[model samples]
Target: MRVGSMIVRPLHHVILAAFSFIMAFPFIWMITSAFKTNDEIWAYPPVLLPDKLLWENISKAWHAAPFDLYVFNSVFVSVCIVLIQTVNSAMMAYALVHMRFPLGRPLLAIILVSYMLPGAATYLPGYIILSNLGLIDTYGGLIISNSVSVFTIFMIYQAFRQIPREVVEAAKIDGAPHRRILWTMVIPLTAPYFVVTGLITFIEMYNNYLWPSLITHNPDLYLVSAGLRSFFIEGGAYGMNWAQVMAASSFTILPLLILFIFAQKFIMKGVSQSYGVNKG
Candidate 1:
């Protein structure tokens, strides 16, 4: 049995290593292609590694578009959505978990059901409403439209539910106000979940393309995703600079990668707790 187990373990390791490399190959290609020359990028056989690192690829991409403004717009929109969604979701989750309102559970059910609705189903209606409000091409338009994320609310609600009811009851018996309990106790208790939700929300908003593309026509209002699309469509020699495009894409994805690496601990904790699987 011990010899068989040893043989299986090595086989398992090899399989996992191969799978990881396969999954990571595109990103590796993207990073490497970002530094390759145009000829190298579209070479007959294609190159896995560049002959020489062309650092100019990055600078050329930066100058090819108004990435500074695009970055600022992306950061601003993502931050706004994250902040607003976190606070709102926390409040809503807290109420549903702790408050005694009759409509609370039904409201939660409705919100969860809404999550099943495809984003395509709501785009037309959302666009009409935003048009009526004259918010098109404005930051408020983008931020306000996405201020509420159903997934964030649901995840936080799950986290809040896992909190022991006895502690909340003790706080209530001690004459603590709902708001006080929520802020001072419940929120702190679920800090890991908040970090996880906020990080996810930031990444989603930053990468969002379709809604921003359809809603905002002004170049100045373009987020990173939208700006990258336009840049690719209208770019250099024969309307394409593959190296620059890859370089910009790499920079665009770097922050999210860094964030995930740094917060993976908290993210895993939050996921486990939300699923009621966290023990000890």
Candidate 2:
């Protein structure tokens, strides 16, 4: 049994390593292709590495479009949305978990059901409302339309439910306000979950394309995803500049990669805690 177990563990690790490489290969190829020439990129043998690194491809891509503005817009909008979602989700989750209300369970049920609905279903109404309010082609339209996220609320609710009722009751008995308990106690305890949710929200907002494209006709208001599409089709001369396109694609995901590298531990911790709470 011991020998069998040892063989199984090694096999499991090898399998996982193979799958990891397989998943990462495309990203690896993109990064490598960024340094390759147009000819090398389309080489029949598929050049895995460049004969000589062309640092100029990155510089050329940067200058090909208003990428700096697009990147700034994406970062600013994504951060703003994450901040707004964090606050609203925390408040809603706190109320749902700690505060007694007549419609609490039903409200939660409704929210969960809404989550089950496809996001595309909201586009028409969202567009009409934003149009009526005259928010189209503006940053406010982008940020305000995504202010409330059902997923963020649900994730925070799950985390908040893991807190001990007795601690909250003690705080209440001591004449502590709900806001005080939430800020000083609950939030600190669930900080990992907040980090996880914030990271997820940021990535989603940053990569969002369809909705932003539908609402904003202004090139300056384009998110990273939309900007990349534009660059690939228009700026890259309809894929004639493959190296520059690869370079642009490579750098666009840099922020997300950096974020994941830093917050990976917190994400893992949050997931484990949430899983334990659900199991309990």
Candidate 3:
């Protein structure tokens, strides 16, 4: 059995290494293509690596579009969404999990059902509601529409529910107010979930293209994804500057990559702890 296990372990490692390479290929290609010339990008034999790193790609791409404005819009929207959604979800989840309220279970069920509905299904109604409120083409419109995420609420609720009831009851017995309990006990115990959820929300909001594209007609309000689309379409004299597009793409993704690198430990810890709680 030991001999068989040793052989299987090597095979497993090999398989995982292969899968990791496959997963990383697209990103690697994007970065490499960013530094390649247009002709080199579409070279006959498909150059996996660039012979000469054209540092000009970055400057040219930045000059080609209003990337600064798009970046600002993306960062602002993503941060707002993360902050608003996290706070709202945490509060709501705490209420549903720890408080005794009428129709709480049914309310949670309704929120879960909202998650089942495709985002595309909500586009028309969401647009109509924003239009009615005269919020179209505004930051308020974007931020308000995305502030309450049912999926975030549901995930945080599960984290809240995982807390041992005895701890909460003890806090109450110690004359702790609900707000105090939430701030001191609940927040500390469940911070991992909050961080993970906020990161996920940030990524979603940053990558959002469809809703932003539809809601905002103003070019100045374009988010990174929408801006990338416009940039691709208007590649100036050299139609579809592949290298420049790839360069812009690299810039869009680099911050997210850095964030993930820093935050992945929390994500892993949170997921593991949640599962461990379930098993216990």
Top candidate by lDDT: 2
Instruction: Pick the TM-score winner.
Output: 2
Candidate 2 C-alpha lDDT tens digits along 1-280: 9999999999999999999999999999999999999899889978799999999999998988888888899999999999999999999999999999999999999999999999999999999999999999999999999999999999999888888999999999999999999999999999999999999899999999999999998898998889988868755474688888899999888889999999999999988987887787
1 or 3, which is superior by TM-score?
3
For each candidate, the alpha-carbon lDDT, in order, equals 0.90, 0.93, 0.91
Q: Candidate 2: minimum summed lDDT over ten consecutive residues — where?
A: 230-239
Residue pair clashes in candidate 1 = none
Worst 10 residues of 3 by lDDT: 231-240
lDDT of 2: 0.93
Whole-model lDDT, model 1: 0.90
List RMSD in Å for every model shown.
2.0, 1.5, 1.6
Give, for candidate 1, the lowest lDDT window spanning 10 residues.
232-241
Per-candidate clashes come to: 0, 0, 0
Candidate 2 residue spans exceeding 4 A from truth = 234-238, 278-280
Report the error of model 2 at residue 215, Å: 1.1
Off by over 4 Å in 3: 234-239, 278-280
